[model samples]
Target: MKITVDLDPKLVWQIQSEAARRDLTPGAVLRERLVSSRNTLELENRIRSRVMSGMCDADIAADLRLVVGTIAAVRRRLGLRPNRRKPGWAA
Candidate 1:
């Protein structure tokens, strides 16, 4: 599958750098990224659909926050702590 695309120079550079670091070509990097992005979008769409189908916003928010917190806690337990601030900072 060969296709032409008009990509931003900065993004192209980043992709190229990542490809080099990973010993892969730009095409492979792009394909992997596309697949991952598509999966994430699909998951988000499914969640949104569920949320829109008579689910309470507070309950949904609480469930999502709990999941996120659990993931963070697991990461910390596994020594993979992220470098972000606590969840509720003034944006």
Candidate 2:
């Protein structure tokens, strides 16, 4: 399936650069980049929201369907301390 998107010039340049570096077509490079970027953003947002709402690491681990260390890593990246409080929402 082919879809049309209006990529800005900067993005186009980045795509071309990555394509050249990886020996991939621009489309292939862009697709891989977008997929990973979208997934990472979604994962980070979920973890960030939960952490900001004061969810515990273990609970967040279960909520995100990731390991406890994954939750800790996101917290570290976001500069958030563990919310030692009990889980904000029911398990």
Candidate 3:
């Protein structure tokens, strides 16, 4: 599909540099990024739904840690509480 959209200059430069390093065209790099982002979004949605449905906190924490090691820090920074508390920490 042919499409045109304005992009940040810094982002464009980074994309071009990466494409050159990988010997891929800018379009191919963008396509790969888009596909990766789509899969990540789908996976995150599935995980979030499970978490919201009362899935065990340890399991969710493990999954998040595996996917993004800084997730806990980010959550804390955002003041977002976990859906479940660990054992022995119950109030």
Candidate 4:
């Protein structure tokens, strides 16, 4: 459910600056920080495990119908770990 929000001008500027620094759009950064920054949920955990299991973020997000940034945020919270097969590409 997408909602329209009226953010303070300063906050918007800060978000834009952070997005530029992170090489992402403002919306992507906001989603990562606000939505995905919440405690890891069931779906998020499953996505993290799949990511840790060597599935790419693009693939996982596509399969789960979620944004890549959300997947990335969840992955960050889960910390880096070796996949079951321990592929170098996963590192």
lDDT of each: 0.62, 0.87, 0.66, 0.75
Q: Model 4 off-target regions past 4 Å?
A: 1-40, 81-91
Could you tell which candidate, 1 or 3, scores higher by TM-score? 3
- Candidate 4 yields a Cα-based lDDT of 0.75
Per-model TM against the reference: 0.62, 0.67, 0.66, 0.42
| Stretches of model 3 off by over 4 angstroms after superposition | 59-80, 84-91
The 10 consecutive residues of candidate 3 with the worst lDDT sum are 67-76
Q: How high a TM-score does candidate 1 get?
A: 0.62
Which 10-residue window in model 2 sums to the lowest lDDT? 82-91
Q: Cα RMSDs of all predictions?
A: 11.1, 4.0, 4.7, 9.8
Put the candidates in TM-score order, highest first.
Answer: 2, 3, 1, 4
Clash totals for all models, in order?
A: 0, 0, 0, 0
Clashing pairs in 4: none
* Model 2 lDDT per residue over 1-91, tens place: 9999998999999899989998999999988988999998898899889988889888888877889998899889988889875734654
For residues 26-87, could you state the per-residue lDDT of candidate 3 as single tens digits? 99998899999898667566556645665444555565555333444434444445666556
- Tell me, by lDDT, which candidate is best: 2
